[model samples]
Target: MKFDPNSNLVYSTDTGRISPSQVEKVIPEGDGIIRIHKESKGRKGKGVSVIKGLALDEKNLKTLAQKLKKQCGCGGTVKDFNIEIQTDNRELLKSLLEKLNYTVKLAGG
Candidate 1:
């Protein structure tokens, strides 16, 4: 990540900046912030995992996913507009991101 002191904005080497316009969480019908959940759709069916929230792009998502993957000692990646992890450590990830002012919600599960 790159920090432009003049603008007081922290920039990512990939996503450039962590701005509100860069992150988005879609709420399904009858869902609110706390209703968020992690979703996994394998070859079988969709299962709810431990996901706090989601980011919108590969650049920002990859950076965040990498950090979580490292901390959790697992593998994770960014695909489409979703950040997917191989472990079930959403609580840890939530705390880490909260330090960066990212909002988190537990949905579905």
Candidate 2:
């Protein structure tokens, strides 16, 4: 509980690190499976279509999100390995993804 400047020791190992541990880049698996769903709980009943389980790197994911947003004529964003489109158009997204050769699944009540 006392500061010891003379001691050659570190009080905290992660004082100024961005990430606690190194995150290895993921290699996307074959014909990655993508799951889409509609979520409205946190958005005050304005449901947004959430796409998950896409085995793509960050760059590719971002590009895909942009394309999908344009095709759907809506706005969207990519975050934490998932894409969220600002609409409840699951079928349109599913078909678009399938055309890109990715296996797609719909989830949520």
Candidate 3:
């Protein structure tokens, strides 16, 4: 038989029980401050507002992203615990987030 490095024995008689590898969800931690910034590096000069430092679960983050997008009348998405709104209006986003009682700050130049 050929050796397969990618395959692992799930169980063996001598070992009795073998557990498979577990995948863990990564949660982002912040300093209780929400930051909004503009980025246009890879999107062919199309700017996007990136909101970070939100200490919420994935579901809540999505919900918040939806609300913000709706209120801003724009499109956005939640990725890696950050919200990416397809707009360059950081001030509007900052005000909206502040109205929701989140400590907001404008980051980057």
Q: What is the C-alpha lDDT of each candidate?
A: 0.58, 0.85, 0.90
Better of 1 and 3 by TM-score: 3
Provide C-alpha RMSD values for all models, in order.
Answer: 12.5, 7.0, 5.8
Quality of model 1 by C-alpha lDDT: 0.58
Which residue pairs does candidate 1 place in steric collision?
35-107, 36-106, 36-107, 37-107
| Model 2: how far residue 2 lies from native, Å | 20
Model 1 regions lying over 4 Å from their true place: 1-36, 40-56
* Lowest lDDT 10-residue stretch of candidate 2: 16-25
How much is 51 displaced in model 3, in angstroms?
0.3
lDDT digits (tens) for residues 47-85 of candidate 2: 899999887888989999999999999999987788999
lDDT string, candidate 3, 1-106, tens digits: 8977997646568776465654346787899999998999998999999999999998999999999999999999998899999999999999999999999999
Number of colliding residue pairs in each model: 4, 0, 0
State the displacement of the C-alpha of residue 78, model 1, in Å, after optimal TM-score superposition.
Answer: 1.0
Better of 1 and 2 by lDDT: 2
